[model samples]
Target: MIRSVVFDIGETLTSDTRYWADWARWLAIPTHTMSALVGAVVAQGRDNADAIRLIKPGCDVAAEWHARRTAGQDEYLDETDLYPDVRPALQRLRDAGLWVGVAGNQNHRVGDLLRGMKLPADAIGTSSEWGLAKPDRRFFDRVAEWAPGERHEIVYVGDHPANDITPGRAAGLRTAHLRRGPLGHLWADSPAVAAADWRAISLHDLADQLTSRPGGAVPAPSM
Candidate 1:
C-alpha cells in the first residue's frame, strides 16, 4: 500500500501565479512581456537562479512585489491560501493511513506561506532548507529518509515535468502531474494520464496507485 504522499508546494497546492502576474502589472511591466522573458530563459535551459538573475532588478523587485501583494506585510500572512480541495484531500490521505508531506523549491518565505495556510509543520519540506531542489536525486533521497521504508511506497505530486514528475519517477515513486497551464508541450512525449482539480481526484487516487503491485503503477513517462 502507498505509505506516503509527497507534494510540491507552489502551483500544486497553492496558486501564486496570480500574485506574480499582478505584481508584474503593478510594476508597469505587462504580464505577457514578463512571461515571454521567463519563456526565453526556460527555452535556454537556464537554472532557477540564472533565470531569476536574467530578469533584472532582482530580489528588490521581488520583495516589492510581495510587499505589495501582502499589503506591506500588514496582510502578508493573510495573502496565502490553500488550493480549493487541498485541505480535504490532505485530511483524506491522513485518514487513510498514508503519510502526507510536502517537498518543494521555495524561498525562506515558504514557511510563512505554510503557516498562513495552517498546514501541519510536520508534513512540510522545502529545497531552500534542504539545500537541494527538485529534479535532483538528493531531494528525493531526503524525502525517502523522512518517510522511511520502501521508496516505491511513496507517491509524489507536482506541477513541473522536470522538477516533479521526472525526478520522482527516477527515484522509484509513483508520480502525479497537476496540470495548470501550458505544460502539455513539456510532457508531450509522455504517455497520457488523467487530470483533476484539487477536489476531483483527491488523495485517494494517489493512494490507490502507489499501493498497487509493481508495474501496476501507471507510467508517467517524461514529456
Candidate 2:
C-alpha cells in the first residue's frame, strides 16, 4: 500500500503562466517571444549551468515584469492559482492514511507559496532546499530517506514525466501521471503503468495501484 504521496508543484498543483507571462512583459518582450528565447537557450545543448547563463540575464527582466504586474496590488503575487481539484485531492490522500508531500523544481520561495495557499508546511521539498532537481536520483533518494524505514512505499504524482515520473520510478516508487495536458506521452515511457485525471480517477485509485504491487521495480517504459 502507498504510505506517501508526493506531488509536483508547477503545472501540477499550481499554474505558472501568469508569472512567466508577466515576467516576459516586464522585459518589454512578447510572452511568446520570451518563450522562444528560453527554448533557444535549451536547444543550445548545454548543461544546466550553461543554460542558466543564457537565462540569468533575464532574471532582472522577470523581476521587473512581476513588479509591474503586482504594483500596488498585494504583497504576494496572485498570479498563481491552485488547481481546482488539488486541495480536495490532497485531503483525500491524507484522510486515506497517506503522507502527502510535495517535490518540485522550486526554490525556497515555495514555502511562501504553500503558506499563501494554506498548505501544510512539513510536506514540501524544493530543489533549492534539497540541492537537487527532479529526474535526479538524489532527489528521489532523499525522499526515500525521509520516509519511515527508508522504504519505497511511496507514490509520486506529477504532470511532467521527465521531471517527476522518471525519477520517482528510478528510485523505486510507484508513480501516477496526472494527465493535465498534451504531455501524457512523456509518462507513457515511465515505469508507471497508470495515468489518471481529476474526473476519471481519485486518490483512491492511486492507493489501489500501489497496494496491488509493492516494492518491486518495474521495467522502464518506452518514452
Candidate 3:
C-alpha cells in the first residue's frame, strides 16, 4: 500500500509566472520574450534556465541571484502562487492517512516560503537545502531518505517527466505524472508519461485516484 505522497513545487503545486516575470523585469526584457525563450528551451528538451543564458550570455545565474538578495530584490512564493486545488488535494490525501510532503528543485528561499505557508505537508525541502537537484538519481536517493517508510510505499507526484516521474521511479517509488503546466502539457501524450503509475489532470484527480483505490488504499504494485 502507498503510505506516503510527496509533491513537486513549481508548476505542480504553484504557478511559476511570477517567478519568470520577476526575472524578466530584472533583465529588463519583456515578459513575453522571456516566456517565449522558456517555451523554446523546454520544447527542445533543454533546461529552462538556458533561457536566461540565451538572453544574457556569460551571465552566472547563481551569482546574479546572490546579487539580487544583497540588493534586497529577493522574490519569494506565497499562498497566492499556489494552485486552488493544492490545499484541498493535500488535505484529502492526509485525511486518508497518507504521509504528505513537498519537495522539488527549488532554492532555499523557496523552502523558507513554503514553510511559512504552513501547508498540510509534514515535510518540505528544496534542491538548495538538500544540496541536490532532480533528474539526478542521487537526489531521488535523498528523497527516499527524507520520506518515511519503504520506497515502494511512497509515491512522488510532479508535472516534470525527467525530473519527477523518471527519477522518482528510478529511486524505487511510485510516480504520478500530472498533465498540468508547460512541461506537463508538452509531454502529455509522450511515452515518458506512459510508464507512470498514474496520469492525473490535477492534484484532485490524483488524490481521488489514490484514495478511491481498492480497500481505500493505493494498490500495491506488482513485483
Candidate 4:
C-alpha cells in the first residue's frame, strides 16, 4: 500500500524561476544566458551550483548569498512561487488520507521557507539537513525512513531524471518524473524518464494516479 508521497521542491511542487533569475541578476548574466547555462550544467551531470562558478571563476557563492541577505535581497520562496498544480494535488492526496512531504537538494533554510509559505506538506527537509543528496541511494533510504513504509509504499516525485527517478527506483520506491524545471524540460524525452513508474507533465497527473488506485495499490507504470 502506498502510504506517502514525497515531492521534490524546486520545479516539482514549486517553480524556482524567480530565484534563479535573481541569481542571474546578481551575476550580471542575461536571463536567457543563465537559463542556457543551467541546461548545460544539467547536461554535464552537475548541479546548478556549478553554474555560478562556471560563469565567473572564483565567485564565492556563500559570500554573494550573505551579501544578498544583508542587502535585504535574499531569494525566498513564497506562495506565488508554487506551481499551480501543487496545492490541489497535495490537497487531493491528503484528502484521500495519504501522507505528503517535500524533500530535495536545498539549503537548511528550506523548512522555514516552506513554513512561511504555508505549503501543505506533512514533512520537509533539505540536503543540508538530510546529509545526502538525491540520486544517492542513501537519500532515498532516508526518505523511506521519513515515510515509515516499505520502499514500494512510497512515491518520490521530482523533475530530474537522474537525480529523482534513477535512485528512487533503485531504492525500491515508485518514481514519478515531472517535466518542469530546466533539467525537467531538457530531459523530458530522455529514456530515464520514459522508464519512470509515472511520467507527468504536472502534479495533477500525480493526483490522478493516486486517486485512480485505491487501497494503496500503485497504478501500473505509465507515461
Candidate 5:
C-alpha cells in the first residue's frame, strides 16, 4: 500500500527545455548544439551538466548559474514549463488519501517557484534546501523523511534511475520510473529502470495505478 508519493522536479513534474536553451544563449551557441552535447554526455553515462563543461572546459557551472542569476536570468519554472498532466495527476493522488510531496535535485530558488505555484502538494523540498543531492544515499533518506508511513509505503518517482529509482530503492522506498525526459526516454528499457516498482508514461497513469492498488501492495517490476 503506497501512502505517499514524492515527485522529482525536472522532466518529471516540469520540462528542462528552457534551462539548457538559456545556457546556450548565455554561451552564444546554437540551442541545438547544447542539446546535442547533453545527449552525447548522457549516452556516455556522464552527468548532463558535462555538456556545459564540454563547451567550455574547466568552467564552473555553479558560477555560471550565479552569473545568469546576477544578469536577472535565473532558473525558474511556471505553469507553462510543467507537463500537461502534472496538475491533475498530483491532485488525483492527493484526493486518493495519499500524501503528495515534490522534491528534486534543484536549488532553493526552484523550490520557491514550485511552492509559489500552489500545486496540490503536501510539502515541497529541494537539494539545496536539504543540503543534499540525489544519487547520494543521504539525499533519498531526506526524501523518505517526508513520508507519513513506512518507507515501503512511499513511492519515490523520477525520470533518472541512478538518482531516483536506484537510490530510492536503497533508501527502502518504492521506486517509480517516470518515462518522459531525456534520461527517462533514453534508458526506459534498461535493466536498471526495469527494476523500479512501477514504470509510468505519465503521472496520470501512476496516480491511477497506485490509487487502485491501495492496501494491496502492488508488486515491484520483475528483475
Candidate 6:
C-alpha cells in the first residue's frame, strides 16, 4: 500500500507561468519567448538550467537566481501560481490517511512559498537544501527517508518522464506522469513516459483513484 505521495514542484502542483515570466522580465526578453524556450527544452528532455545557459551563453544559473533575489524578484509563488487541482487533491489524500509531501529540484525559496500558501503538506524538500536534484537517485532516496515503510511504499508524482518518472521507478517507487507541464503534450508518446504506473492529466485523477482504492493503494492503470 502506498503510504506517501511526493510531488514535483514546477508544472506539477504549481503552474510556473508567472515565475518564468518574472525571469523573462528580468532578462529583458518577451515572456512568450521564455515560455516557448521552456517548452522546447522540456520537449527535448533537456534540463532547465541547460536551457537557460543556451539562452544566455556563459550564464551562471546560481548567479542569475541570486541576482533575481537581490532585485526582489523570484522570491515566492503568488496565489495564482498554484494549479486549481493541487489543494483539493492534497486534501483528499490527507483525508484518506495518506501522507502528502513536496519534493522537487527547486530552490530553497520553494519551501517558503509552499508554507506561505498554507499547503497541507507533511514535509517539503528542495534541491537547494537536499544537495541533489531529480533524475539523481539520491533525491528520490531522500524522499524515501520520510515515507513510512520501504521505498516501494511511496508514489512519486511529476510531469517530467525522464527527470521524474524514470529515476523514481528505478528507485523502486511507483510513478505518476502528469500531463500538465512542459513535457505533457510533447512527450506523451515517448516510450519512457508509457512505462509509468499511472498517467494523469491532473492531480484530481490520482486523488480519485486513491480514494476509491482499498487502503489507498493505487492500482495499475488498465492497458
- The prediction achieving the highest TM-score against the true structure is 5
- Whichever of 2 and 4 has more TM-score, that candidate is 4
Instruction: Name the runs in model 6 displaced over 4 angstroms.
Output: 214-223
lDDT of candidate 4 over 1-223, digit per residue (tens): 6788899888887787888799899888898888888778878888687888888888788898999889888768877888888888898998988899889988877667886776777888888798898778999999999985788889999988888998899898988888787788888888888777777777887788777873343443343
Q: Pick the candidate with the highest lDDT.
A: 5
Q: Report the C-alpha lDDT of model 1 over 7-28, residue by residue, as the tens digit.
A: 8876677765664465456556
Look at candidate 6 and give me any clashing residue pairs.
none
Over the stretch 155-212, how does candidate 3's per-residue lDDT look in tens digits? 8899999889888988898888888889999987777788888888888888888988
Of candidate 5, the 10-residue stretch with the lowest lDDT total is: 214-223
For model 6 the local lDDT of residue 140 reads 87
Per-residue lDDT tens digits for candidate 2, residues 133-155, read 87788988887876543445776
TM-score of each: 0.70, 0.67, 0.93, 0.89, 0.95, 0.90
Question: What RMSD value applies to candidate 2?
Answer: 5.9
Q: Rank the candidates by TM-score, best first.
A: 5, 3, 6, 4, 1, 2
What lDDT does the true structure give each of the candidates? 0.61, 0.58, 0.87, 0.82, 0.88, 0.81
Between candidates 1 and 2, which one is better according to TM-score? 1
What would the per-residue lDDT of candidate 5 be over residues 1-223, giving only the tens digit for each residue? 7788999999999999989998999999999999999999998999989999999999998998889889999987888999999999999999889999999999889999999999999999999999999889998888777678898888999999888988899889888888887899998888878888888888888887788886544454332
lDDT of 5 at 117: 95
Error of 4 at 118 (Å): 2.1
TM-score of 1: 0.70
